[model samples]
Target: MLELKNINKAFGEKKVIQNLDLTIPDGTILAIVGPSGGGKTTLLRTLAGLETVDSGTFLLDGKAFDPTNTKEQEQVVGVVFQDFQLFPHLSVLENITLAPKMVLKESVQVAEEKAKKLAGQLDIESLLNQYPYQLSGGQKQRLAIARAMAMDPKVLAYDEPTSALDPALRQQVEQLILNLKAQGVTQIVVTHDLTFAETIANQLLKVEPK
Candidate 1:
């Protein structure tokens, strides 16, 4: 389970999140949806350890942890950005293996093995040698997911996953999320698509600006 307690964040003057509390059970998909300036992405960034909260407690599976500790959060939370930020200079295999080899200090062979497995699961094994520019939009999305999954995080969070996809591709992402849940991965999605959210999310959180 993942729990956020009394979370608060703000810019210089305007508060984005205020006294927010949420709980998500293991293997559940929770979608964060709201208006444009309602701080949905801010909340997601805080969960991903990319933003610091003024006050909050993060409880993962009943154990409390520091949200500002980026290194520790990297192992526990993986994020797929809105743009599918694949490194343009790296091949698919390189993109997926880089973090594990660098941050986790895994052997090259081990990282390659893990990357290959994730690629196969995402049906991108044959494109391992291809660069990001060579991939289609849907393929790039899967590669982004594979890269995050390579870290073996307990929680996977996506920011606007379907923003650039067509209807068919959107359905693919929905199923992909469900498949991950079946494998016991907890997920949080930040999206503006209410239809998409209702289709995949086990729980929905509607945030309003403070």
Candidate 2:
């Protein structure tokens, strides 16, 4: 189980999350939903160690989970940011392979092969040599999803995944996410599409502004 105890986060004078507690079992799909600025993204960022929490304890399977512990965290969770934060300088393949090669220390061949598989799954294989700036919004979002999947994380978190896609593309991505459940991957998704949330999430969490 993954548990958050009395989590609190603040930026300057603005407090985002406070006294928040949540528990997620392995292989569960969770969706965090709420109004804008209600700390949905903040919570995801805190979990991904991209934001600092004022006070909180994240316990994974009864053990303390330090957000600052990057080495161990890499194996535990992968996040798809709202902005699709891709590397501007790297090609599509490089962006997908960088972490696996550097963090997991896999060989170039191994990383490239994994990237190729993900690119095919994401239907972006033809654009492997293109940079982030060259891809369209939907393509960039797909790239972000592929990049996260390349890490082979136990937990995957997506922030407003369908916001950048058209109706058809959104449906495609939604189905792709649903497929992850069978792969034994726990997902935490934040999406404005209520129907999409209903279809993909086993549990829903509403984040109210504090």
Candidate 3:
């Protein structure tokens, strides 16, 4: 569903994402691993259309990313930001369904139904009535994943998803990844968790030092 070729980016004199090439087909979970500051997160940002690449071609579902032509690219990519960008004021269910209801114009009933179902599937239904502040790190991450999935994105991307969790919580998140892989959620994730990499990803890519 996504393809990138000859991607190049730099900050001042330092270069990142040099001549990078990647293709992610539908329903494939791809894990991208790299050392710190090796541009893994930058790569994710580029795919999410959050960072501009100096030179590259990025295509999502056959339509390339064009800043001047945004309609074609927007909403085709769903990103779970590294910081878990949840709305502090909204409850979990509200946060998850906001885009579907406001952006997609689904009815509140429909959106809430979908959100609650997804939350239950992700084992976070009990937390839906609560706010993000009431949840733990893993719960927050799960909430983010639920929100992303609620939008019915063509492709999903995550950054350092479980990097800050404890070992037990990390395992729980790892299992969640495997569940997504099982359910055919096409994903690109920047992760340091090698265990999740070995288990869930159909392909593993390591970003080598430039």
RMSD of each: 1.3, 2.0, 2.0
Residues 1-210 of candidate 1: C-alpha lDDT, one tens digit per residue: 899999989898999988889999989999999778899988878887788899889998898877567474257778899898889999999999998988888899999999999988899999999999999999999999999999888899999999989999999999999999898889999999999999999999988766
lDDT by residue for model 3 over 1-210, one digit each (tens)?
788889899998889878888889988989998778889988877766677989989787887765334553256667898899999999999999888988788899999999989999999999889999999888899999999888787788889887788889878877888788778888887887777777778899898666
Question: What are the Cα lDDT values of the candidates?
Answer: 0.90, 0.86, 0.84
What TM-score do all the candidates reach, one by one? 0.96, 0.89, 0.91
The TM-score of predicted model 1 comes to: 0.96
Q: Supply the global lDDT for candidate 1.
A: 0.90
Ranking by lDDT: 1, 2, 3
Q: Give the TM-score of candidate 3.
A: 0.91
In Å, residue 182's CA in model 1 sits off its true spot by: 1.2
Instruction: Write the residue-wise lDDT of candidate 2 on 1-210 in tens digits.
Output: 678999998888998888889888888889998878889988888888778789989987898877767574256678998898899999999999998988888899999999999899878999999999999888898899899989887688999998768889888888888877776778899876777888888898877766
Residue 197 in model 1: shift from native, Å?
0.5
Q: Which whole-number lDDT from 0 to 100 does residue 57 have in model 2?
A: 92
Compare the candidates by lDDT and give the number of the best one: 1
Worst 10 residues of 3 by lDDT: 66-75
